[model samples]
Target chain A: MIGEYITSNTEIVESALTQSLPPAWQIPLPLRESMNYSLMAGGKRLRPILVLAAAESLGGTKEAALPVACAIEMVHTYSLIHDDLPAMDNDDYRRGKLTNHKVYGEAMAILAGDALLTHAFYSISQAHKVHGIPAERVLAITEELSAYAGARGMVGGQAADMLGEQGITKLEELEYIHSHKTSDLIVFSLRAGAHIAGASHAQLQALSQFGHAIGLAFQIQDDILDIIGDEAKLGKPVKSDEKQQKVTYPYFIGMEASEKKVRELTSQGKEALLQANLVHPERLLQLADYLMKRDH
Target chain B: MIGEYITSNTEIVESALTQSLPPAWQIPLPLRESMNYSLMAGGKRLRPILVLAAAESLGGTKEAALPVACAIEMVHTYSLIHDDLPAMDNDDYRRGKLTNHKVYGEAMAILAGDALLTHAFYSISQAHKVHGIPAERVLAITEELSAYAGARGMVGGQAADMLGEQGITKLEELEYIHSHKTSDLIVFSLRAGAHIAGASHAQLQALSQFGHAIGLAFQIQDDILDIIGDEAKLGKPVKSDEKQQKVTYPYFIGMEASEKKVRELTSQGKEALLQANLVHPERLLQLADYLMKRDH
Candidate 1:
């Protein structure tokens, strides 16, 4: 039942994402094509799904949350594009296909990433203009978005990660990197959805707690999978982390400890949400379980 | 008098821009340093000044408009940093100082640009949260901001410019690039200031006219200055455009025609603002005149 729920919501998000941009002729052809190329490349749609599930749990309609969902997905896609640049990770492949820079050239890819980032805010405002959400709520979501996505959050984490690449001997530093780089956007996604649904202070706080727990768990799981997962299912080579000599949860502790930590954190995340008094949270609860156990 | 007005306003903007970012300890050191490096390097402060001038022209407080002004400057600075990347323009100097990518590596420069762009909306929301702007107006500014700065606006123009670098033989295509690239943000700054001041539709329309005339005029003046201006005053080499073999206003229309067009557009811009029935149009009118005649 949870699998079907995710599949259905993923479909909704994919369709909305397609319709978000103007027609090709409307924007410059190359800019529109570059943006669409990465945006349409398939993913688990995890962030958008978190948005919808959080909104639905708080008694909000999908129509009202869809734009914000698509917006977060755009941000995620743009980050991936920039991260894959030659100056950054230099990865030529993502999800078993050519990365954005690999196909569009670095210049167009950079501008395309930029355009997508700028358009995310445009999408949030649409939630108010087109879907009739309150302006105050939309404004709140926009504030949270910049706070989480900007320097002190995701970007800060990225900087630390890059700086730490020289050598990371401390676990606190690694945690800091994971929390900011991986978890900030997750927190923003949940909090944005909650804002759309007019969630109370307590509920918003609860979602933040849940977001942090699951977000860290999700990254730890990625680390674990990199050590021992099927290459085809993962859509990239396993143990590439080892190949890169990058530090990971398994490296800091052990594979058994990392897997055990994922279970604990996932349970803690679900428990936090359970106490929030949401109208419907079964899907979200099931999502935590599914995420913790997933192979890919 | 216009010189004093710009100088005073520039100081106010500079102070606020400094205060806008979190302190060095709060954000990652490298990111904070990189963002500040380019942001504080200093240009004419033209866009932010435009925001404040338009707002003040319509009876808005400098305090209320200051955050938005700073936000727009952040957006402009981010564009410059990204534009200066080796992958983009390969520029190594800006405002007589090393470019962000020159001092910081390409990776941090890119992240700094990303952070600045993200922080811009954060600063806009601050106009409401800290400055008491109405939520609806703030929301409207946010929407217009994304439209003007995103794929359809500045980024679209940039893409077209890059594509046209192969060869831009047609005046129509050059105009499209200039209008979208140069004019949209100017138009947005005027309109955003109008929104902040609660200006009427007629006032907004007048500002749009003023913005377009002056925006294209501004670009033409840059082209003319590249040919005739002092390298020391401009902080960059003259005839650099011809050196790059890049297309310019004078390249096609001839120097005399380009100079004439700048004057005509500046007069038209002043004329439009004069018709708007503003509380204070003298400064803005003087600004258009100053911009058209500037050597730098």
Candidate 2:
């Protein structure tokens, strides 16, 4: 299912992420080097692809969601860079290569993350140059992206994650962390696409619900994979959470139950699209299924 | 002169900075706490006041520049928090109190700095609602602020400083470091005020020149202060720069020459404002003199 979507839109997503960055001369060499290092690192480009898929599914062209999709990926990359820092996750490798801090040193890594995150908004605002979009919609999209990436969203999730690592773990705590850390950006990506495509309010509501369910399912699948996936395939150590005694869905609910929960959530996510009468829901539904069933 | 400006605008600047932040409830408590800690820690509110003073000097109301002022300070505070981290300057104290990392662990400090920087733009965008500024103007202001704070500006300066600490020291290198590290934000603060007030292109150019001169002068004076000022008066260690063997202006060009350089720069800064025929030029002239002649 995922392979079909990838085959169809893979070039679009790849080109968008690769070209999203400014020209080399515009940015200082070292800074550009650090930013490009992590951005060009291999990954699924999942968030951005989802953005395009959702927009197309809503009967909008890929151009409408291109900037937003790129911005989401930039934010995601920034999170990964910061998360790998010594003070945070402290991982030495990511995607089978040295993490940003390990390669660029701690200070530059931090600044690189910061620069990328700040630049993401600039990218979104530039999307206003798109010929037909209304100014109000551009402003609204910019505002929504900021809220999701700022304290109320991703940063809030990070703060909770840090605190959670050091404090007692509860089901509520895990849910809060997952929702904010992982789900908020996903919700923002879909909502932003809908807003750009001029989706109706009811359609937006359904899309948002679809985003939330699939987002949570994605995290749950991650938890399951961490317990059983191969390190080489994952491109990072597996079972690190178990070794660290970190709380996760699989750890708390048992693997079998966690798998069942993912399946249920995936179905609900697909139901949201059906309710909205989305024109082409196959890609999104398949994405949900792929997320729930992926090994790594 | 800076002292007079600070004294006269102190109340307005302080009130704006405090109120610019969202209420604790809107932001997560931990993020709010960290932001407030660095923001409210007593220091010269030089940047924010410059922003307001520049706007007022151009016949705009204090309200016009309030958000830009607060955003400049937010950028400043974020830099300070990050600079004080163990991987950076490793300072345990700032403004005579435990630094953000010292008070709140390294992880929270990192997150706090990230949150503040991201929220700074959010604050700028909110200016439209608060002050009835046009979104285009706000976007321009944000773009300028981002350029000053990002890799090409303050962060670039910081990287230069870090590299200079470990390599060959030249007068040009020292100038580059100070210009980027200290002056870029100052230039941005003044330009932001001009942008907010919708100053003429000519007036903005003059403000840019004035900002550049004063920024360099300010850093030269800081270099001098490290060698000559009392530690208690400065609120941080004295001669610490020399002790650490960090490249500094006074070290590159003897203390006497550095002082002379500051006097020359201050006169040039005042001359820029004079050429512009700005009303209430005394506020900025006084600031230039104060920056060049400050004891702390």
Report clash pairs, candidate 1: none
DockQ of 1: 0.88
Residue lDDT tens for model 1, A1-296: 88898899999999999999866775889889899999999999999999998999999998999999999999999999999999998898889989998888999999999999999999999999999999999999998999898898888898899888879898889899999998999999999999999999999999999999999999999999888898998888888877877899889899899989999999999899988999998888888888899989
Over the stretch B40-140, how does candidate 2's per-residue lDDT look in tens digits? 88788889888887887777778878878888888899899999999888998887899999988898898888878877887887777678877766776
Segments in model 2 whose C-alpha atoms lie over 4 Å from true places: A1-4, A7-10, A22-28, A57-61, A129-135, A198-204, A273-282, B1-5, B25-28, B274-282
Question: How do the residues B1-296 of candidate 1 rate in per-residue lDDT, one tens digit apiece?
Answer: 89999999999999999999967887889899999988999899999999999999999988899889988999999999998999988987877798999999999999999999999999999989998899999999998989899899999999998888868999888888898888999999998888899999999999999999999999999989889988888888778777878899998899999999999999999998988999999889999999987878
lDDT of 2 by residue, A1-296 (tens): 57976766767766877787767765557777898899889788888888888878878888878887888888899989988898988889998999998888898888788878877776777666653455556666666776777777788888888877856467777888888888888988888877777778898889888888989999998898888899998988888887877888977789899999999988998898789878887878888878777777
Candidate with best DockQ: 1
Model 2 TM? 0.92
Residue B190 of model 2 has an lDDT of: 86
Model 2: residue A111 alpha-carbon error in angstroms? 2.0
